[model samples]
Target: METNTEPQLPYMPGLAGVPAAESKVCDIDGQKGILFYRGYPIEELAEKSTFEETSYMLLYGQLPTKEQLDGFTHELVHHRRLKYKLIDLMKTLPETGHPMDALAAAVGALGMFYPHINVMDAAQRHGACVRLIAKLPTIVAAFHRMRRGDRDVLPNDKLNHAANFLYMLNEQEPDPFHAKILDTCLVLHAEHSMNASTFSARVTGSSLADSYAVVASAVGTLSGPLHGGANEDVLDMLQEIGTVENVIPWLDKAQAAKRKIPGFGHREYKVKDPRAKILQRLAEQLFARYGSTPLYDIAVKLESVMEERVGSKGIYPNVDFYSGLVYQKLGIPMDLFTPVFAIARVSGWLAHWMEQLENNRIFRPSQVYVGAPPRSYTSIDRR
Candidate 1:
């Protein structure tokens, strides 16, 4: 028998369960369905902290002092406005283009306008974080309006981050209740452990790319249907179900046909996603305030039926489940769902970028090539 001589390397498809890098930015207890950002439980932060404060914590690894938070928020508020040239550039994008593509394009172009090319400078990194977190909502809202031939609604200094975005998107001030709900949504989405987009940011940052490029790469990754568009899909799923009575039949048909029920399962969670619980409550609150809708009723029935069918298998509602209903109630357009996710996750991406820079090593993972080993090229049309 010929002796076999080949390296035996364990392969994990999609790099699953691989420890890509050490990160202090965020962690998940998948077994328990819990998430933490910089040592704070997500529940505590979502209940007690604002997006700005959560962003500060994720960036600096600690909650800010009162004075520190005030200063940070002031910087964010002041930097919210985009340069007119950037706005003019946004006007030139095809109005019907996906918002995520527009966002990625604008952000990549942003690299040309800002002086954040120096990735090693601490102050420059901080400025880049502030500018990105502040301006993303403005950029997203601007494109939303411009595409509709509506004039840009300037950011309101008096409003906090979430409310301001709502105001800019809709050209009217949002209710305080609605603003708080949106803020909690942002806090919940701001970070997750080693997610695809954060990993994209880290890998791009490993090349010492500037902040804009790093974020743009992550945005592009998130635009893919597999990663960031689940919420929108969930909304569509709800709309298709149409009524509480239709849910059981629809889910039965979907499961029998082996179609994935959007928002019903997560790779990371054996239990219901904690963020989904918060979002569900927010949805109920929204319904209570605005009165109920057919979609929410369908969502409720679907969750109950799904729990009965597969809950024992640890297949349950993830964050995307109820979040679509919440977003729809908040009046965000369906196409803007992922862009809003990008808005929240930018802080997390930057946090990962900074953490990647702290121990900068270019990511060059090896692969197991399994093609024909040594085949010589023959002359064309050789018999």
Candidate 2:
């Protein structure tokens, strides 16, 4: 079939080979190597706003006043407890199930329990957002405890989001320094215009499904190594390399064999990912406050080598590089790294769902189908 050669839409700047996700909000100036969230620079928000505050700002277009933030915090803490039905469902999962898999299943089950979650109603949507933000820690902690045959740790309402999550996970209230690190890490991971997971959410919501349904699908996407689990893999990569001395040969050999670094090369920002810088600072703080760990040394050495090796090719760390170190240092098992990402990202995922519903258009992008010409079916006996 002959087809018109002229492009229907304006030629898009990036192709599928690149790592760009097309969400209306955030943009990265790869040439200048700058990153912005809802048009606000990451550094500005990182400096001025708390994780909770930034999350609220991203969800609502405007930043919340003090009283509104207080109310949101109160609401989040008040609902931190799991619903009885949800707890019962969690009890049924095999203890061997991966925490990420378990959380995805539990969150999806929540949608069935409250199937009427209105994708359009701001209040109802915020209710879902609050539930996800509050309860993810509880679910994650419970899964961890269950796997290890330990008792569940309940949430403490008096603490902040970062402290409360750490408290629940560790069964002890974390000190200010540790909580602060977690707060910054969560803020860094909060939103990106639309990644594979966020786009998965939007695409699912385009079908007009409830927010939970879309988020559940997105969680599955985030569970993948290429998307969110790269943090865990980076830790694994470092562990396998074992020392600063090993960094060079491992990287050179991987490069020689044509392997892309797990934590390098973003599709949107050709220069570097802004979130990587934020996480790198947190990792540095953790390393500086506490005496050195071999993993930290390995990462630093790898960074220097990789920068010299791949700087011209635009291969650099994304959000995953240092996140594993934080979790590992926090005494969190390596298995739960991506689940932590999901916990923080639930806020952004719901924010996008709300955005999608506001002037609702189904997310149906046309495919450029390239295929064989129409032909008749062959006869059954034609050998």
Candidate 2 TM-score versus the reference: 0.91
- Deviation in Å, model 2, residue 52 alpha carbon: 1.4
User: lDDT score, residue 127, model 1?
Assistant: 94
TM-score of every model? 0.97, 0.91
Per-residue accuracy of model 2 over 84-182 as CA lDDT, tens digit each = 778778888998888889988988887877778766677788888888778888888887887777777889988998898888877899988888888
Candidate 2: global Cα-lDDT?
0.80
> In candidate 2, which residue pairs clash?
19-267
**Residue lDDT tens for model 1, 1-383:** 33346775798998988899998988888789888898899999989999999999999999999999999999999999998999999999999999999999989988889954689889999999999999999999999999999988899999999999999999899999999999999999999978899899999999989999999999999999999989999988998888888888898899899999999888899999999999999999999989988888888889899999999999999999988889988899989999999999999999999998997999999877777666668988994
On the 0 to 100 scale, the lDDT of residue 208 in model 2 is 85
**Full-model lDDT, candidate 1:** 0.92
Report, for every candidate in turn, its global Cα lDDT versus the true structure: 0.92, 0.80
